[model samples]
Target chain A: MLPDSAPLSAATATSPAEEVLTVEHVSKSFGDNHVLQDFSLTLHRGENLVVLGKSGSGKSVLIKCIIGLLPVDAGRITVLGQEVGALGHDELDQLRTKVGFLFQSNALYDSMTVRENLLFPLRRHWMADRRGQEESMVMQALDDVGLVETIDKMPAELSGGQRKRIALARTLIIPPEIILYDEPTTGLDPITAREISQLIREVQQKYTTSSIIISHDMNCVRLTADRVALLVEGRCYAEGTFQELQQLDDPIVREFFV
Target chain B: MNSTILAETGAITNFAWRFFRHGFRPRYEVQELLYQCYVVGYQSLPLVGITGFIMGIVLTLQSRPTMAQFGAESWIPTMVGLTIVREMGPIITALIFAGKIGSSIGAELGSMRVTEQIDAMEVAGTNPFKYLVVTRVLATTLMLPILTLLADAIALYAAYIGINLKGVTTLALFTNNIISTLTFGDVVPAVIKTFFFGFAVGIIGCYKGYNANKGTEGVGRAANSAVVVSSLVIFLLDLLAVQITSALGLN
Candidate 1:
């Protein structure tokens, strides 16, 4: 097996960088069922790392633990050099401003318009002196996502693909340093999924944001990922570039490629 | 089952503590608070008015024959005035408020929870409790008494109408009798209890909704549980208020 934290062959795109997020020996269990056991991974700055897993392989659990939505049973998660569990509530809230999360459902506030959605993060973090700049920042984010026309519309009025785009725009509004994408392209047609994948790459390049993308879609993995990690039975079974992992002879890793 | 009950109680207590803690911070949600007040207070006036009107008419009609049988027919104004003012007005109005506002808050928050809107808010560095729970709780705590006051006024008018339909008491005489019967002791205790009623409704609804799980079905469950618990809590609080008021000779 390749060594842990192996540099991918396509590492030419991103410059050498320090670690941004580190999940070390994290273990989680629910009653009698163990979800994640001894899982460790480090996310380098300004690289797209796609985590590939099967349907019930605890991908969402990992994301939840990282964001402190769920507490880990027996390990530590450090984001931006701060231990996730060590921070108080307000501190965590402040830290989250720099770490954006794109949920699988888009999680757009249905009660809010697209403009309101974009403004939510800016207003919540209490970014003062954004009077005139707020409008332009919102416009820029919407423009980046190519959905400036949807500013006045509510999330319910948007299609599935449009909702995904708007959700990404909401995350990008604040220009977070690290983004955690939970199944960014799960519930869409292939065309839309491909488009979302391309957008993910565009976001990574444009913002130079380090992202940990958890997805099962091969097309998404192929288009967005600079490195791929195979999570089997709650552990990182292998890690390499898309091409490196694609040529593996192991059946479990081969199952994904075939 | 016992563990579940204990866990739930503990959860609600923690939720209440966090709500108060978060409630006392900056970044206050002034717009949302005002909007909730308008929703929980202003929009509920019509329902509370109709219910109060019906209650006045019915209580007057039902108690009339009994008062007449006791050779106390002339005491109709005093008796109806006291009953509606001291008990019926606050209790019935509070129950109606609990049903409408409590269920609405619960369902709204539960839907937000299931759809991950609450998570989104937290991730975006917004305190959902301060924005959603505190504003709603404070609105109900402050508005229920006002609504009860309005309902009491409407009910008194309907009582006046009820009296006119049967007897020939002048408006001045009816007004004098009501004013004389309802002392500060009677009105103050009754009104004071409604604040508690409002607090209970708001807190229970928020607790249910914010902690709701089990997906779409949980939304319905939260709404249902909110109404049931708040309504029950209202009765229990009414009983306690009566005892305290009686002990203090305010009844």
Candidate 2:
């Protein structure tokens, strides 16, 4: 495992040698059921790390704890060098502005049109731009996801695949330094899933941002992950690159990708 | 016979208690409240307005014949005004509000959660409770009173039209009679009760929608629960308010 505070150099794409996130010895439990036990991982400035696990293996729970969605019963999660739990409300909102999350369901606000969906974040953060730079920024994000033509359409009008793509566009509209993707391609057809995988790769290549992708799909783990972690028995059972994991003889590792 | 009603009452009480625990906590959502207001208040105004007008006219017309037997037809305006301000206005307006706002909130939030939008907000570093529940509750609290007042006004106007349908009372006399009969006690108590009605409806909607589980079935349950609970709360609060006002010699 990478050291929690290990400094970044070549992988530091956003700034001059910065470690994006450091999570150390995190443990979470729901009463008697332990979801995450002593889980730890460090995300570099610009790399994409995919987490793979079987169903009910605490993959989503680990990321949720890191993002402060599910309060960690134990351990530490630090993002951009600030402790996640110790931050107050304003601080948490500030930190959140820096991070973008793509939910498993796309989570596009159904009340809004695609244009409005893209504007939700912009409207919330409009205080930052005195000059109003969002006209070009929104168009650019939508263009990146190949959704420039569907700006006026509501989410209910869009197909499942289109919704995921629009969600991806919204994620980039924030220009976040770190992205947490929760099952980015779970319910899509193989072609759409592959397209989503390609979009993930494109996002990684285009943005000088780091990401933690939570997916059970091995093809995604194989295609986009620079490193992979298997969450089993409420802990990181194994951590390595896809190739290294594939080569392992252990039943847990073999069973995950097989 | 009592068992079924007792069971239903118990279920509602338990649900209200859960909502209290979740809603009272800091970082609870208020976004759904705004959406609810938009749906329950703004979108529903036209329907309630029309209904209130017709209700007033019909009530005035129906009452005139009965009062005419005692040559008390001149009391029509006072009677209509009292009915609108005291009872018909509040109950009908609330039920209409329940049908529109309560159901929409329940269905929308239930669907959002089932679709995982609530979870997405949490991951995106936004508090779902603040974003979803708080706005809707606050909006309802603010809007419901305004809606009820509007409904009461329209209903009174309709009652005037109803009075004119059968016999003639000059608008001035009609106006004077309505004004003289309307006490601050009647108006204030009725208005005060509306705020509770809105709060109950908003809170019940948020509670049902937020805690919804089970998928498509959950959405139905949420909507069903919201309407049922909000309607009950409206009547219960009305009963309590009437008692308090009577005790204080305001009735």
Candidate 3:
């Protein structure tokens, strides 16, 4: 067992190239709750799929099923042609290394500084050889988020928006083929939100990796998403471009967007 | 049966089985385990140690005169050792752990769940349970016994000191008295129960925190449940452990 002090560095994550993620009709429930019901969504390589929903709409649960965080009562999730829910622990981890996540609250380890956080995915022996390149990539990712100045700071030392950006940097530094963002713009001000939206688009353009963003922010949905899906009542109620979705005049879409 | 209670019980049972399975798996999440130990064990030493010392000393001091009234002061060492190692030692340490490690784990996972970070792990083709929950639970299970051992030692030492204050006795004589009264029977059961204490603390903390919902309120629920449930489980498990240990003739 590697000592607990070992860092999770970004160097260990990169995969061959672009990979598409697919989630078929997946349904999940905790007893009577029916948390996710017949949820279906498709993510293409390098495409950004934005999910917008109300507070209890199961938008997040849909993502969880796709990545096997929560098991589906039925259906399948395939990432890069491998079935996600069917895989064993090691296989699942191997798949995780290829995906990056930007937590809504910027779940940076409070114990570590920005530099240590940036090197987290790469510091372990598994990523030891790729450490230098990962470090450089992290620097570039931090630069992309306008957080290059705060490398020495702890998560508490940064502003909320800055923390979100650091989370973005953490997600991007690993240079994974898929990146998922949850509430990427929820707590930010208009200007900062715009900056984040721009950054998301920039990442899509740069990495050409598939991305799925879970958010209630309409502006974010409109700006960075190539296609939008409204996850409600345990299912993908609707899926389309923002324009297509906006034109539908569905009550759920109106409630979410307006 | 009411589903909430029934399901909770079933969930507890199911989680217990998985914990044993994944806890010993290769790639032991060594770092996460250490992080938990550091968070759950090392940092908690001072508090648990102090608690154990006072528990032993106070128990001895209070009971000494009482026992002396019955001409039974000699039971001080065995009594202190039994109280510290078997019950107070594990229970107090777990409560401290429930406060420190439990709340932290709850708050951490609760915030992650609310923020959708845990979801992101899933979309990235990661098993959030394995990465987040299993590693953490395993870490707690492994470290709690070690912490209990340390607390047990500290408490016994404090009991000796307490005994010295009120009466006259040589180190050898005091030590001999303790040694003669104490047996593997006392130590083994006391130590064995601690593992349960630790496991209960970790598992209850994880279950409450990981299953939290309702955003900000979820975080509160997680922290609150971590402490309340783990604390309750300590007593429940202590009862079960004692029953089993006595039944097995380890008493």
Candidate with maximal TM-score: 1
- Compared with the true structure, what per-residue lDDT tens digits does model 2 show for residues A8-118? 112212344467888788888888987777778878888888877888878888777777777888889999888999998668877887888888878898888999888
Q: On residues B1-251, what C-alpha lDDT tens digit does candidate 1 reach at each position?
A: 99997897788778878878888888888998999899999999999999999999898888889998999988988988899889999999999998999999999999999999899888877788898899999999999999999999899888888888888778789889999888999999999999999998999999999988899899999999999989998999999999999899887
Per-residue CA lDDT of model 1 for A1-258, tens digit only, reads 334543233222556579999999999999987888888888999999998999989998898888888899999999999999898998898888899899999999999899999997787775666656888999999999999999999999999999999999999999999999999998899999999999999999999999999999999999999888888877888888898888877777889999
DockQ of 1: 0.78
In angstroms, the error of model 2 at B176 is 2.8
The clash tally of candidate 3 reads 12
Flag regions of model 3 displaced more than 4 Å: A1-79, A82-93, A99-111, A121-132, A180-183, A211-258, B1-3, B72-100, B121-139
**Arrange candidates by TM-score, highest first: which order?**
1, 2, 3
Q: Give the Å error, residue A150, model 3.
A: 1.8
Residue A10 shift from truth in candidate 1, angstroms: 12
**Per-candidate local distance difference test:** 0.90, 0.81, 0.76
For model 1, what is the error of residue B247's alpha carbon versus the real structure, in angstroms, after optimal superposition? 2.7
Candidate 3 lDDT by residue in tens digits, B128-242: 5666788778678878888888888888888888888988666676667767777798878777777777777778778777788999998998989888878888888888887
